[model samples]
Target: MSIEANLEKIERLTSKVWRSYSKEDPLGHLSFNEYDYLKAIQAARVPIRLTDLAKELEVTKPSATNMVKRLERKGLVLRVSCSEDARSKRVMLTEKARAPLESESEIYTIIAQKLKVHLSEQEFDALNTLLTKALR
Candidate 1:
């Protein structure tokens, strides 16, 4: 297959996998925007400033603040005053966020296990290497 054709196939497969996997998340009960915000906080290795999150999410400061407040109410995230900057606040994932994150991870693991039926170990390794390079 041509490179373009392979890329198209990968895109299609990824979409299908995500759609199917997301159905299993109770968090799917939340709006897509809310889920996205929560996922971003969970993915961040460290607490992130509200302004930084706004920039990362391409949202306004008020919008980011509102979303963080909602997440805090849901017990998925906590907003704390930044120690380094008195006026700024940072968002961190709460223990409540772990269940949903772990559930999502399990879904991905299941999808990967199913895909392994079609891909050999070497093919999977090559695909991982290529994807990492392409992402860079």
Candidate 2:
């Protein structure tokens, strides 16, 4: 197949895989974007400034602010004045948010197992390596 044809095939399959998990309620309380932001906040290890979060997510400052507001309303995240610069605000995940974030790891493990069903061990490992490299 031509490269274009192969790429289109990969896109279609990727869409299908995303759809398989997109509508599920593994995270019943939070939308995917909210959960994603929470995951990012947790991974940061330190409270992150709103501007930095926007940069990390490649979103506008206003967009990131809106998302953080929504998360605050849901009690999943907290925004506090930056200690170093009191005028600026930082965002962090709450203890309550950790439970759902932990659940996501389990959910992904299940998803990974299902995805691997069609491939042999070698094929699965190769796919993992190739996709990781491509992402980088």
Model 1 spans with C-alpha error above 4 angstroms: 1-24
Instruction: After the best TM-score superposition of candidate 1, give how far the Cα of residue 106 lies from its true spot, in angstroms.
Output: 1.5
Displacement of the residue 105 alpha carbon in candidate 1, Å: 1.3
lDDT of 2 by residue, 1-136 (tens): 8978977876676666556665654456667688778878988989999999999888899999999999898788899999899889999888778776665665466556866998999999998999799988
TM-score of each: 0.78, 0.71
> Which tens-of-lDDT digit does each residue in 1-136 have in candidate 1?
8999977886677677779767765566678898888877877779999999999899999999999999888888889999999999999988777687767776667656766788999998887788799998
Model 2: worst 10 consecutive residues (lDDT sum): 18-27
- Pairs of colliding residues, candidate 2: none
Model 2 alpha-carbon miss at residue 38, Å:
2.4
